[model samples]
Target: MPISDFRKKKLLYVFNVFFDVNQSGTIDRKDFELAIEKICSLRGWPSGSPQYTKTFDSMITIWEGLKKRADSNKDGQVSVEEWASMWDEYAKNPDNALEWQTQYLRFMFELEDASGDGTIDVDEFTSVCSCYGLDVAECRLAYQRMAEGKQEVTYDQFVALWKQFFTSENPSDPGNFIFGKTKF
Candidate 1:
């Protein structure tokens, strides 16, 4: 099953914020590359080093996926309009939607699990959630539910949570906690 329109849009909105690294009101492959470069620099990764290949490759893979799917104009880039409107097209096709969701989860986990520990700590969780414009305090509470008393969320746990978040419509599910409290 595909996620609800509201939930799916919320996911896209968060990703749009993260991908638009330059705040240029658009997102493209260059933005993903720049984001990786900055992230590597901040982590003290050496220039021209191979240590950052996994991170860089993951971003490139995601960019390719987005371009192949969401670049409606075939213009070799994804505009804000294309990002926002792609879900409307994907939602009508459950198989395509699920494929995107699964692939997206893999990409996001690779990005957020910065320590290569196969888990996301609170700080990482908070940083990812912030992109969605979700309040920090509310995210704090939601993190607890998602973490389920653990200090971090493992890839398996994250996958289960994402599956629920993507496919379930019930508000009571912890997956609904992805963005914390939704304000009208």
Candidate 2:
């Protein structure tokens, strides 16, 4: 599928966040989350919410996916140098939307998995919202609903949810986008 204008804008914002933190075109896990948090704060997201939790989960999912292709050093963590290498590889072939989305999902997961504990906490949840310009309370409600039947959203589930939120035919439906805004 062709990339939507909204998705392009969202991806560009994400890229800008990456560049802002990894100005040298490199990023460690901490740097990555910090950048996301900064972006979320700029976007006016509340300090806590289910939406934030979902965002955090999404970051982790993104990192996990990227880990497959970018963790060439086998260090179990993405270092700044490794990120530079990965970014180069991505830039060389930026047209692959699926790859880009997968990488993004993993990045989201990493953001949520603060403390490197492989699980999300309240603070991490708030921090993720602070990066995505979301309202904490509103996000929490959404996250609660999304996670109601499941303890955690898996990678594939994350992708499906993200696609529904960002690329669905009816973006205006609050039932569609995780955060409610159609344009991301």
User: Which candidate ranks first by lDDT, i.e. highest?
Assistant: 1
TM-score of 2: 0.41
At residue 70, candidate 1 shows an lDDT of: 85
Q: Whole-model lDDT, candidate 2?
A: 0.52
Candidate 2 residue-wise lDDT, 1-184, digit = tens: 4455554554444444443365544434555566556645644555576646655556556666666666687766655445445544543454444464556656665655565656544445556654556566655655545444445555555555655544444444333434322345
How well is each residue in 45-156 modelled by candidate 1, as lDDT tens digits?
6666775786687678877888887888898877766775675554455445645456767867866677888988877776656644667776777787777768988898
Model 1 segments beyond 4 Å from truth? 1-5, 88-104, 127-139, 177-184
Give per-model TM-scores: 0.70, 0.41
Clash totals in order: 0, 29
